[model samples]
Target: MSKSQVEVNRFKVKAQLMQLESDPIAVEEPLQISLVQNNKSEIFSLTMRTPGHDKELVYGLLFSEGIIENSDDVERLESQLHEGERQINQQEVILAEDISIEWSRFGRSYASYSGCGLCGKTSLQALELKQSRALKPIKSKIDNGLIRRLKALLAEQPLFSQTGGVHAAGLVYEKQGELILSKTPFFEDVGRHNALDKLIGHELLANDLNQAGLLLLSGRIGFELVQKAIMAGYSTIVALGAPSNLAIQAANQFNVALIGFAKDQSFNLYTADKNKVVCREPLD
Candidate 1:
């Protein structure tokens, strides 16, 4: 488990303007997840992910992809960071052989997720999730003022704020018009999907999965992201940018409320019900 760590940053020049001793942060690291089973071999995603939470990342990946259904289905998840050298322990996952994963298709590279990318897939014969009918009403409503403030807060968390090179996601809660964040945590990755996978890992570890709030992304909403929202049980998903067609499609299918282009005094609600703030015209 010692090798199960990675060096995310290295000493490099700042803006190529000055070579520093401390090293700029390395936000991404390679993680090779080993899949083991009888007959078929374990294929890896070769995901270029952020350091830490590698175990949860693998669990989320497998669960979200329909590879495994519940915790009982999973035997155990473990890692070894490239044999040694203080890098992410790059994990070797052991799952029941009834589950098969084909890594060749993953292309030994980073894979981004669209919460619903599987909606159109035709050949993934695997165990389906045992989730019940979504209990919340289709619509989700939030105070107009909180929506505005959350938008502002979502724009602030990235560690790469100075570099503008990372994507971020956070679980946010609203109580009495005040926005409260989960002690869980947030993540910033070179890829938006990766950032979310990290966030999911954090949420799972903290066991703060009430699923009573919204997921705020600093990027656009996509099918893969929508899938995460569903798996995470988040009722509302808000993005600071436009949403993709597939993302909207999945949101509708899963009954999760979706909001996009959330900035300033504007936002659009997609496929959700319950809480909303309709703006009334100001009196002259």
Candidate 2:
């Protein structure tokens, strides 16, 4: 079994009988993250996440939190593994010597659960102040058909198919008039935010965030998820579920094309810069 899930024996209760069966449960574990700079290390976050692609998770977290502008700002990442075990519960991020961090903006350290995305923020005002400039408008328009196709791809998620408890995030990039889902840019996690972070982190490391891509989420779009997408320079976002009010507002503020409730035939476009995303006309 993959480390992302664990096999458990549980009682399956039905209308008439109870049977014991082996099921796959998504694994959730605490990962303590520390930032190292100037020979000083400080633990800033403790997040519950699935046990895999930890390096991408850290990169995504740092990027979303505005700790690092790019992958170059992070010198190296060191995993603290338990003795005699391959499981890692801690990670140390070494920043480049020239990098400077504004701790005041970071607010306080807190534990982030798998279900909550904005757990440690001090206030909405502070979060608003940290918003970066609006993303550059994309030259290509996303086809509604392509947006609908994303839902069908969910069956490809390995972890979600097994546990049905994890969220997934994927990036579909526009290349030479074709929308292609990059092989390595999709990630699944117990947390929606962590899934997006892993996807963004992988692109950040590859220096591919500049590509015109659509961010796809298997779950609802919250304000935090939209904020992360903006920070990562995504201009278009499509989700399989609904979007929160705050999420719509943030997307508008950043001029992001946010689409939600992506079904097999229809989806809601909450906010869009017409120049960036153009939808096809309705059929008679």
Candidate 3:
């Protein structure tokens, strides 16, 4: 066993030296996804990730892309770190009967980072094939109370309060009047999209997506988060920060209640048609 070497940078500000460790400096790791087919051997696709949750992350990546629909499609998994290479050994899936998959689509070279969700090839086609479900409109209204609670909860995240480097997604539980606490089931990532994906992957395994509860992010609501949230059946999304223009547009098209800038009892509602947000304002 040995200490993992990390990078630390030094800078100066106001005649002072500042040193910080940029947490998630990328380490090249392999995402070995294997689907054992009957003909002769197993097939695999190697991908690069920030590491951790290699298994469920792989499953979620495959499932969300329509590459592997269920757990049954997984053959077997093995992993090892040798010569500084994270080698994942995969066993080919051999079912009791015949199975068919368009194996050609599993290449990671063609997959874009989840944060940068749109590429010419996977855009419209994925929307049609995967997240085609009509999102339910927001039936209840969110008041100033909700916005205040969201920002407070987001600020309370101990990780970002320290590192300022990770992303988080949690289900908010509103209890006694004006009191809210979030249930954190997943909190680990350099990307918001990965945090959401990891949470959704765990929930899907447990058959719990309807409770698609409130999402409090450390940063702005980007297009991919909006898209993934809608696809996962969460009609309402609240971010402690702002919302990108494309994020708002996607939420409107998908019928998701897009709420942003959730701080100091203020929030911007992007989809009034779906959210019970004020249709008109006193600011007028």
Candidate 4:
């Protein structure tokens, strides 16, 4: 089984009381992604991520960076763990023979950290990714009752329940005009972006990116998350935390409906037209 948390002993001190207890900690590890095409290979990115869904992570990374458009663009994906190691440290992604990579455009030293997504880029412009086509508009609405249930869903997270030190992301879809998130890929990572990427990658691998759904984030909505959602063709983003100014701007530009600080049926709509979000009752 893939372990998301590790058990460790820690000393807690408070009010002249000290206690030694066993605690679970979220696991963090390095993941190196390499791209191979036409018998040539190059290191694409090195990121700090929780050890799971490695193949999905690679798919999300490649899709977000505009390296691969459709799932067919990838010829093969291989992952290997170092000898005597329990976690996978490296992954290789081979592109289809007909696809050509823009080496010069992606040529930059990048060290992706677990805390933020736009790390290692020299300029602000580098953060903006150009897409070959605009994201198709999403035409769906989730009720307030369904939104409130997200808290319960998050509460059931085994990793977060044990460690309380990870971000989570999930995908929700509509059925018969009602939102239903059944067996959605729930990902948890020390980094919020990585969690979202894992979910995106999982969907990409299934070739189900065109499904009408909302990307629910356990934390704040940021520019990177918005960009990744856009790249992954997600039309709506809902979060349990606040949205950054840049994230709102990006969502508005890309026509993504962004919601933040969602709790108990109350949420702040940061982007998209007012009519785009239909609540059963007045929401704050």
Best by lDDT: 2
Q: What is the TM-score of each candidate against the true structure?
A: 0.51, 0.55, 0.51, 0.57
Question: Whole-model lDDT, candidate 2?
Answer: 0.72
lDDT of each: 0.58, 0.72, 0.54, 0.71
Better of 3 and 4 by lDDT: 4
- Residue lDDT tens for model 1, 196-255: 888877767877565455688888876567766777777678787766654665677777
Q: List the residue pairs that clash in candidate 3.
A: 36-92, 36-93
> What is the per-residue lDDT of model 4 for residues 82-107, given as tens digits with 9 covering 90 to 100?
55557777788989998878878865
Best-to-worst lDDT order: 2, 4, 1, 3
TM-score of 4: 0.57
Best prediction by TM-score: 4
**Residue 4: error of model 1 in Å?**
42
The candidate with the higher lDDT, 1 or 4, is 4
lDDT of 2 by residue, 1-284 (tens): 88876664433322223345655546655677888999999877877567899999999989998888899999999888744445887888999999888887766665564567456632213345244434644555555555555776776788888999999999877777566754426899998998998998898899887777778899987667887998888888888876655566677887788877676555555666433444453232
lDDT of 4: 0.71
